[model samples]
Target: MKVCLVGSSGGHLTHLYMLKPFWKEKDRFWVTFEKEDARSLLEGEKMYPCYFPTNRNIKNLIRNTFVAWKVLRKEKPDLIISSGAAVSVPFFYLGKLLGAKLIYIEVFDRIDKPTLSGKMVYPIVDKFIVQWEEEKKVYPKAVNLGSIF
Candidate 1:
């Protein structure tokens, strides 16, 4: 199955990298904000750029929508997965619009609280997965899969 993994750099990319072994031979596409770590770790994969900000920026959101549109058209992935920090929000929406299963893995950092991106995308995702049981209280529907690591 085709998979599109989207997220910000750092812990989000770390989570997706753990799933890489299970994705052998699948048409896998990765989308993340450019970072030194992701660049070194995910070299040569079909990747896209997303601007991730510490704070919400309206201009970046508009640009991200257009970027997602182009990628969704090209990839048409069967599944879209993310360990998010806002960068994946557009791609997850694209996955839904294109009728692909969307899985949102809550960031490992938010072991106690739901992330802003997680809260925004949770209700629409096919699977809402959290690494911590405490988070399950906030998102009753989430699958407690331990740390995606």
Candidate 2:
């Protein structure tokens, strides 16, 4: 299966990386920030750099959405997964629209609250995974996977 793993750098990326066992053998590529850690950790893996300043930057969000649309069109992945920040919003929606199975993993750090990106994509995703049980209360449809760490 062709998988497109999308996430921001840092913790979000870390969580996504923890699923290497599942994705390592799959036909996969990443969409993430161009950070030193990301470059180092993902060395030898296929990747596409996403736009920065995605928290609330309307301009970059629009730009990234367009980029995501184009990439999704070309890659035509069967599945798209992410442990997210704001950068994931566009890809989640676009991937769903393009008939890709969308999986959103709630960041491991958020125990008591839902992330903005999680809330945005929850209703649309095929699977919503949360690391902590408390998060399940916030995202009732989410499955508690007991942490990816």
Best by lDDT: 2
Clashes of each: 0, 0
- When summed lDDT is taken over every stretch of 10 residues in candidate 2, the lowest stretch is 140-149
- List pairs with backbone clashes in candidate 1: none
Candidate models: Cα lDDT each: 0.84, 0.92
Among these predictions, the greatest TM-score belongs to 2
Give the alpha carbon lDDT tens digit for every residue of 1-149 in model 2. 99999999988888889999999999999999999999999999999999997998999899899989989999999999998898899998988889999999998889999899999999899999998999989999989989787
Alpha carbon deviation, residue 134, candidate 1 (Å): 1.1
Compute the lDDT of residue 82 as modeled in candidate 1: 89
> What's each prediction's TM-score?
0.93, 0.98
> Cα lDDT for residue 72, model 1?
89
